[model samples]
Target: MLLIHQLPPKPDYFRVKIWRRLQTIGAIAIKNSVYVLPFNDEAMEDFQWLRREITAGGGEATVCRASFVDGMSDRQMEAFRPLADHGAASERLPGTGKAPMNKRGRTWITRPDVHVDRIASAWLIRRFIDPKARFAFGEPKAGMVRFDRFDGDYTYEGDRCTFETLLKRFGLDKDSGLRAIGEMVHDLDCKDGKFERHETPGFERMIAGVVKRNPKDDARIARGAELLDTLYESFPAAQQRSRSH
Candidate 1:
């Protein structure tokens, strides 16, 4: 279920900063105060951390689950969160994809312009969730392509339209996470799913940890949304000068 978090009125920077961190824990923002995450243990803990962080930072918050009128949970909310971290960015690849793979999993990330191009990351994640999000091979041999998410043709186009085409092909059930989630995931899919990191960035793992600590809590879920947004926008570059601190 996608989680929604509502916080007391605070500076926009506070919200955005928190959002970026939450994404690292596997949460994605769907609304300004709402985030979407798959049903899993790790995601819940991540949400809880977000709630605590925001509260410690002087922001009041509430986390809740998002569901349609029919009450159907988001089907595409996935286990796609990557396993890397901020410190992990300095690690080097083994020099070849065919080299001995790790028992855990092969690493796949490079220096990302998260602070340089937020639009690109936003577009990438959104596309991954939407299924309709179209893809081109920044790096080939991805699972989606193996699953036939896109034809073997290149479509150098804007994210909005091309993503819609991809969604049409996947037959999107619903768009859960923050609107920006589509953008970021799609960006990763275009570039990293193969050559780079999976790009969920250890979010899924963190979330599972959360659930293990706490069984169920709506407040944590809402906080997860706030954190996811922070993670989503944190990339592509730091925010431009907004309200003075």
Candidate 2:
């Protein structure tokens, strides 16, 4: 399903707000001002909200339930959501591909701008979800699994951040050391005052440095992964103790 909107120009604020809203629902921008999402009840509701907002913002919008024939472009055909954990059923449209993938070789998608939660989530994917996972940015495509992009299968849900959701959903929550890192990510990303770890300030500075140095998403992720690996190894005794069975 696609909720396409043609917004008025000049103000820019309207476009920004609409783009953010579409991002929240994991809508891929197939073309300028045209976004795509899987047809579902939740997706429909999200589009309804967006439609209302767009209309109220002096822009015109419409939601359409769509299906594609064969020979669609890869980007046009890509799935809009992340795949479920192993053994879980994956819903797919005809000609989209097989459902419920058993392994994690799929390309892990996210926004290009890396941050605390996004970087941490990417590290988690390589370290725990899929070691050989490939990565891309900006709207998930068919056959690719996305995280940290609006309603992604592995992204934020309810009160949980993407990192926390990945940890819990993939059964990685048992690792106290990872959970410790997750607390930092949650506090930094959400600013919700949920965790009070003292290492946050220094860690955030380190992340900022990495992001500043590595301008490209692929490069930043590689650098970020190294830092996360080191941090996991150097967790304090309390966190290490939590790792014990």
Candidate 3:
């Protein structure tokens, strides 16, 4: 699916809003004012909605199906693969409320080598989402809940890392400290510097040191959780409470 649009130049905020909507739907830009998403029912619906929004905002928009032949190859397309296949699986748990009680006590799986995002996500699951969340690093089983992996139940959404995704999905986004930590994790894990929080550099170095010192995933997650706990508490108590409400 392709969404091509031209917005009126006067209102700058409208342009940013449209861009963010595109990102939320996991659209990839191939050219200026042109974006691509995997041709699927969800993608088609998303593009249609964006087209309407653009047209209503005093913009011209078109949604169409396109075949990539000349400049883009299948391999390159794979690089920007859409989340359609995994979207249905992830929807089993909605973000409308708190983490579901039925989701507790399940083994969460991920890639063996734990890093900043995985460690933080694991900590989040244990600390807030599920106190008894058991983690395993290997091939996911039939009933295992996965995180940070491509087909996981919880993973990246648009530009968000797994930690940010989990925070948003589990109704934890209102907490200011968790939101700040999510920004730091996003900057470190995605390496995009979208949120260059002043604390991100130090957080990254500390996580790197944790990975270097801990050879096991369990140890890495344990050490990383301690760091994250301290960081979360470092925020002013009033600020955290005010936003959490």
Report the Cα lDDT for residue 63, model 2: 88
lDDT of 3 at 16: 79
| TM-scores for the candidates | 0.30, 0.58, 0.59
Model 2 lDDT tens row, 60-131: 989898777754543544464433211101111111112243547879887667777888888988877788
- Best lDDT among the predictions, by candidate number: 3
- What TM-score does prediction 3 earn? 0.59
Candidate 3 per-residue lDDT, tens place, 150-243, comes to 5557875655678888988788888788889999887666554688999888988899899999999999999999988888878885355657
Considering TM-score, where higher is better, how would the candidates rank from best to worst?
Answer: 3, 2, 1
Error of 1 at 61 (Å): 1.9
- On a 0 to 100 scale, what is the lDDT of residue 172 in model 1? 37
Clashes of 2: 4
Worst lDDT window (10 residues) for model 2? 85-94
Q: What is the C-alpha lDDT profile of model 1 across 145-230, one tens digit per residue? A: 31111221211122222333333334331443333344443433333232233545565444445435444333333334344656
Q: Which stretches of candidate 3 lie over 4 Å from their true place?
A: 1-99, 237-245
